[model samples]
Target: MLHSRFCCQWGNTLSSTLLRFPLADHKKVFAIALPMILSNIAAPMLGLVDTAIIGHLPDAIYLSAVAIGAMVVSFIFLLAVFLRMATTGYIAQSFGANDRAAQRQHFNHGLLLAVLLGSAIGLGSPWIIDFAMWIVQPDTQLIPLASDYIGIRLWSAPAALITLITLGVLLGRQQSGRAMWLAIITNGVNVVMDVILILGLGMNVKGAAWASFSADYVTAAVGLYWCARALNWSPTSIHIKFNALRQYASVNGNIFIRSLVLQLCMATMTGYAARYGSTVVAVNAVLMQFLMLISLGLDGIAYAVEALTGAAKGQRNPHKVAYWCRLTLLWSCIFAIAYTLLFWLFGPAIIGLITDIPEVITTAAQYLPWIVLLPLIGHWSYWFDGVFIGLSLSKGMRNTMILAAAFGFLPLWWLGLPLQNHGLWMALSGFLLMRGVFQALWLRLRWRQII
Candidate 1:
C-alpha cells in the first residue's frame, strides 16, 4: 500500500510538470518569429534581385558596380544595427517588467541616438566615400560607376539609419508584425522602383542606387509616423528626457562595441576576398547570398529568443529563460538540418539561376557544397548572439567576437592563402566555426549568470 501511494504521487508530479509547459506563450513566440522570418527573407530578396537584374546587364560592369555599391552601403548602415539590438533587449525587458514608462523612454532614447548618428553619417558622406574607395582600390574602369552609385546612395544614409532606429524600437516592443509590415513596404517600393528605373528607363547602376534611396526615404517617413503614434508623442513628451538618455547610452555603449566588432569581422572577410581577382570576388558575392539566407533564416529564431529571454530575465524568471534557451536550440537544429538538405540537393541549380556568366557560375557552383556545412556550424553564434543580447551581456559579446575575428579569422585566412580561390571558402568556413565554438564555450561556462 505504501509503494502504491508513492507511485501515485510520483506520477502526479510528472503529470504536473508536463502540464506546466507554457503552450500559449510558445504559440505567441512562433507568431512573432513567423513575420520576423518573412521580413528577414524579404531583406535579402533585394540583394538577390540586384544580382539577377545586374547579372544580366550588358556586362560584368553593372554587376560589379552593384556589388561594390551595396557592400559599401552595407558596411556603413550596419553600424546602426546596434540600435535594433539594444532596443529589442531593453524594450523586451521593460515589457516583461510591465513598465510602460520605461518602454517609452527607451524608444525615445533610440530615436535621439539615431538622429545624432544619422546626421553625422550624412555630414561625413564625402570623406567616407573617398576612404571606402581608397581601401577597396577599385579597377580604373569600375571606379566611376561605383562612385556614381555611392554618391547618390549615401544621400539616403540618414533615412536608412532612421529606419534602423524605428525597427529597433518596434522590435524592442515585441511588435514583430509591425516590423514585417514596414520591411515589406520598403522592399516592395524598392523593387518597383528598380524595375522602373533600371528596366523601364534604362538608367543602369544609377537607377539601382536611386531606387534604393527613394525606398529608404519612403520607409523612413512611414516609420516615423508609426513610431510617433505608438509613443503618444505630445508636446510634453516630444523632447527626450535626460535620464532616459543616460540609460540608453549605457545599454547602447556595450552593444556598440558588439556591433562594431561584428562589422569589422564582416568587412575584413569581404576585404580579403576583394584582394583576389574579380572572378573570385564575384563568386564570393554569389556565395554570400546563400550565407545570408541561412544566417538570416536562423536569425529569426535567434531574434525570438532574444525577445523571449530578455523578457524572462527582466521578470526574474530563470525557469522561463532556461526553457527558452532549450527551445531555441531545438528549433535551430531543425532549421539547420532542413537548410543543409536543401542546399546540398539544389545548390548548382540555384547558382545557375543567379548569374549567366559561365566563369562566375562555374566558380560559385564549385564553392556551393561548402555552404551546406554552414547551417550546421554557423547557426550557433547566430543563436547565441541573441542569448547574450537578451541577458544584456553585450560586453562579453563584443570581446568574444573580437577574439574570434582576430585569433580565428585572421590566422586561418593567412594560412589558407596557398589554396587561392578555394582558400577563401576555407577561411570563411573557419571563421564561422570559430565564432560558434568560442561563443558556445563562453555560454556553457556562464549559463548560470546569463539565466
Candidate 2:
C-alpha cells in the first residue's frame, strides 16, 4: 500500500513536469508535421525518377535535356507556389476564427485563381518554351528533346495548380493525413507509369511527361473529392468576392516576386557551377539533392507551425502562437542535429548511391562536410519562413529573401571566387544564415505589432 501510494505521487510529479515543459505542444506539432514530412520527401522522387531513367540512356544529351526542361518548368511552377502559401494563411486563419463560410469562400477564390492562371500557362506553352530555351541557350541537339518534354508537361499545369490549392486547404484545416495520401497516390502513379512508359513502351522523356500529366489529374480528382467532403460544400453555397480576389492578388503577388527572386538566385548558382566544368556541376547537383532532402524534411515542421500559428493569430492568442513557435524551433533544432550527424557519418555512401561517376563521387565526397553543415545553418530561415507566412507577414518574407540574395549571397560569392566550388557553397550557406538573421530581427521588431 505504501509503495502504491509512492508510485502514484511520482506519476503525478512526472505529469506536472511534462505539462509545464510543453510536451503536449510537441505532440500537437508533430501530429501535423510527420505526415507532411513524409509527403515532401516523397514528392522529390518524381523528379529523381525522371532523371534516373533519362540518365541511363546511352546519350548524355537526353539527361541534359530532361534536366533543363524540368528545371524550367519547376522554376515557373515554384513562382506560382504563392497560391498554396496564400491559401494556407487565409484558410488557416478562418479555421481558427471558426468561420466556415469564410473558409469556403477562400477556397473558391483560390481555386478560381489557380484555374485561370493554369489555363493561361497551358495556352501560352509555345511562347513559354521559346522563352525558356532562349534563356537557357541549350545545345542544338537538346532543343527538340527539351521542347517535347516541356510541351507535354505544360498540359498538366491546371491540374497541378488545382492540386496545390487542395493541398493548401487540407493543410490549413490540419488534415495532414489526407494531404499526405494525395501526394503518395499521385507520386506512386508517376513512378509506376515512368517505368512503363519510359522503359516498356520506349517513350523516353515524352513518356515521363505523360506520366506526370496523368498523375497530376488523378491527384487533382482525389483532392477535389476530398476537399468537397471536408468542406461539406454545395456549389450554390460557394461565394467569390471581388475584394477577396484583390486581397489574394496582393498577398500572392508579393510571394510570387519573392519566389521569383529565389529562383533567380538558384539559377545563377547553377550557371556559375556549370562554368566550373561538368564534373563540378554533377558534384554540386548531388550535394544540392542532399540539401533539398534536408530542407523538405524541415519544411514539414515549418508547415505545421504555419497552420498552428496562423490559427493562433486568427484567434488573437499570442500565448498559443508563442507556444507553437518555441516548440517548433526546438523540434527543428533536433531535426537539424540529427541530419547533421547522418550526413557526416553516411554522406559518402549516399552520394555513391546517387551516381556511379568516379570523378563526381570523388569531388562530392571532398565537399561532404559542407552538406553536413547545411541542415544546421539553413534550417532557421526555413523556420522563420513558416512563422512569417503563418502570421500573413509576407512583405518581410519577400524583402529578406531579396536582401539575402542581393547582399548576402552575391557579395560572398564574389569574395570567395578564389575558393571555386568551396566559395559557392560558402556563399550559399551565407545566404541562408543571413536570411535567418535578418528575418529574425524583423520578427523581433514586429512581434508585438503582429500579435
Candidate 3:
C-alpha cells in the first residue's frame, strides 16, 4: 500500500513537471508555428490556383507564361528577401534582450531598406523584365503574355517588400498569429481578384497579375497597421542612426548575397526547365508549387527556430540555442517524412486535380519521385539557414551556398544535360542532396561555437 501511494505521487509529480517545461515548450512552439504554417501554406495557394486555372485555358502557353512569369517575379523578390531575414535576426535579438528600443530600431532600419530597395526594383522593372525575357528565351507565343504578366506584377514590389519586412518584425516578435492573419487576408483578396479578373473580366494572365498587385497593396497596408500596433512603434519614436544602419547594412548585405545565390539556383532551374519546352515547363511549374507547399510549411518551423535561436543568442544562453536547434531539427524531420509519404501516395491525383493537361499530368507524375525525396534534403538546409541567420552568421551561409550552388549543383547539371528532361530532374535532385550534405556538415562543425 505504501509503495502504491509512492508511485501515484511520483506520477503526479512527473505530470506537473511536464506541465512546466517540455509540454509548455511544445505549446509555445505550436502557438507560434501553427499560424506561420497556415500563412506559409496560404501564400503559395495563389500560385497553385493560378496554374490550375491557366491550365484549362486555350493552350499550354498560358500555363507556361504564368509559370515563367512567376519564377521571374520570385527571383526578383528573393533578391530582397534579406530584408525579411535581417529583420528576423535583429528583432529576435532585441526581443531576447527585452530591449524595445533596439527592436524598434531594427524595424525602422528594415523598413527604410525595404522602401529603397523596392523603389529600385520598381523603377528597373522594365529593364529587369526584358533581361528575364532574354535569359528565359520566351518564344513568340508566350513572350507577350509573359511580358504582360510581369508588367502588372511589377507594381507589387514596393508592397511586397514592405509586407515581407512586416512579417519579419512580427515573426521576430513571436507574433506569428498576426503574420498569419495578414497572409490569409492577402491571399483571400488575391483569390477573389484572380477569379473576378480572369473568369469575370477575361484579362487572362494580366488578370492574375492585377489580382496579385491588389492583394499585396491591401496586405501591406494591413501589415503596416499591425506593425504599428504590435510594436507600438510610431513616428515620434522612430530613431535612425548611421551606426545602426551600418551594422544592419553589413549583416543584410551578406544575407542578401546568400539569398541571391539561392534565388539564382532556383532561376537557373526554372530557366533550364523553360528551355525544355512549354509542356515541360507547365508540368514542372505545377509540381514546383507542391515543392513550395512542403518547403514553406517546413520554413514556418525554421522561422520558429530562427526567432527562438536569435532570442537565445541575445540572452547569451547557449543551452537554449542548442535546445532550439535540436527541437526544430527533430520536428522538421518528422514533417519531412510525412510530406514525402503524402506526395508519393497522392501526387498523381493531386496533379490531375490541379490541371486538365494530360501531358503535363503524365510528366509531373514521372517527376514526382524526386519531389518526394526533396524534403529530406531541402528541409534541413532551410532549418540551418534560419539558425545561422539567428546567429548572424550570414557570411557562413553565403559562402556555403555559393560553394554548393557553384561547385556542387551546377557541375552535376552540366554533366547530366545528355539525359534531356530527366537530366534536369537529376540535376535538381543532386542540388538538393549537395545542399543538405554541405549545410549539415557545416552545422555539425559550427553548432558548438554558434550556440
The TM-scores, one per candidate, come to 0.83, 0.90, 0.83
Each candidate's lDDT (Cα)? 0.80, 0.87, 0.82
Question: Arrange candidates by lDDT, highest first: which order?
Answer: 2, 3, 1
TM-score (C-alpha, index-matched) for candidate 3: 0.83
| Top TM-score prediction, candidate number | 2
Q: Rank all candidate structures by their TM-score, best first, as comma-separated numbers.
A: 2, 1, 3
TM-score-best of 2 and 3: 2
Task: Write candidate 3's Cα lDDT for 156-275 as tens digits.
Answer: 888999998998888888898998998888878888897898888988888888988899899999998988887788878878898989998988898888877777777778778878
lDDT of 1 by residue, 1-451 (tens): 9999999998898566545656775576677678888888886676577568768778889989878988888777877687778888887788788887777777777777877887777778788878888988989898889988888888887788778877866766677898898888888888889889998999999999999999999998888788778766533675678986887777777778777876666666677777787988999888887887786678788888888888888898999888888877777877898899989998887788778899999878777778988789888888888888777777677778877878776787788888775766676777778887888888888877766
Residue pair clashes in candidate 3: none
> Candidate 1: what lDDT?
0.80
lDDT accuracy of residue 59 in candidate 2: 79
TM-score computed on alpha carbons, candidate 1:
0.83
Kindly list the per-residue Cα lDDT of model 2 for residues 247-296, writing each as its tens digit: 88788888888888877777778889988999999999888889777977
